[model samples]
Target: MKLSDYAKSQGISYRTAWHWWKQGLLKGHQLPNGTIIIDVDSSNHIRETACIYVRVPSVEDQDDLDRQANRLTEIALAKGYGVKRVVKEVASGLNDHRKQLISLLKNADYTVLMIANKDHLTLFGSDYLIILLDQLGKKVEIIEDINNQSEDLVPEFMAALRIFSQKIYGKSMTKLQVSHLLSEFQKQFAPEEH
Candidate 1:
């Protein structure tokens, strides 16, 4: 396909496509007449379109979220994975109903889902998602495989316990009671200050 058509298909400007071609991020060749032809099939075989997914546990981590997205974008670009989109969201990894994530999963534009960490996508069942995406001819690329890294798991545990307690206690357990219980639980496990 012509470079212009390829750029149009990718929803990018001609100049950007030309730049990518020059940077060797795109596979193609220029003819004697200065017309560039893109080897779409070859490029698709070598590099898949990527959708960078970035998330934070809360709004307070907005800066971290931007940093995460930027880092993933750099990685994706450096890998020559044509980045189709970067979806950023402020939501708990334990939350199952993240709107942007759900939407991204349903969208078929990209073949690769790039993320900073597994927990950035979800705290649990990330393998299931990866399997499903694989079944759908899509894949996930984790920049930092920190799955076994030592980190604070108290907040996630408390969130899960709170959810289960709410479900079990129904309307009997008030929000205040849950919060109090979680607070105490956190205090017990929290690291001591110097």
Candidate 2:
């Protein structure tokens, strides 16, 4: 169906539909001949998934942070989360503080929360994660795996080992090694965290 037709069927204006497409809320595919096709199923998937938000630095160097935000948005969408509001570096990390991340942590509604790294944790550490986990207790599951693998298993395994290795060995491991070990000891770390 044409964009106008789809918009009419949904009782919304075509302009609104175009806005969603631009925001990545609605997806469109271009045909070989140059016409675009909108996948209603995928669009419906977007409607169903939970909102995934990103917080980044709003400095003159927003290019890199924008790319990072997009990467994380893709990961969250793949895991079946919707792309909701993006609270950019609206939160500052000055003087070892993260008011925005903390506010997000306090709210704790998202299915998953993806952060950059330890610097993020240093500003907002395990204590912050635990605080959200405790408040969200049983409402949602929290996973802290940061392995940028193409497969789900790798991320799951890495998350497990991240918790296990830290608990057992009290040491940090690289994402690549964690991904490898996760594949090696899949059964050993099948148990869910929290």
Question: Largest TM-score belongs to which candidate?
Answer: 1
Scored by lDDT, the top model is 1
Put down candidate 1 lDDT per residue, 57-135, tens digits, no spaces. Answer: 6555578777888888778767766678899987777899999999999999898999887877899999999999999
Residue 18 in candidate 1, Cα distance off native in Å = 4.5
Report how far residue 86 has shifted in candidate 2, in Å: 2.3
lDDT of each: 0.79, 0.49
For the record, the alpha-carbon RMSD of candidate 1 to the native fold, in angstroms, is 4.9
- Candidate 2 segments whose C-alpha is farther than 4 A from its true place: 1-61, 90-97, 134-194
Q: List the residue pairs that clash in candidate 1.
A: none
**Candidate 1 C-alpha error for residue 142, in Å:** 1.2
At residue 141, candidate 2 shows an lDDT of 29
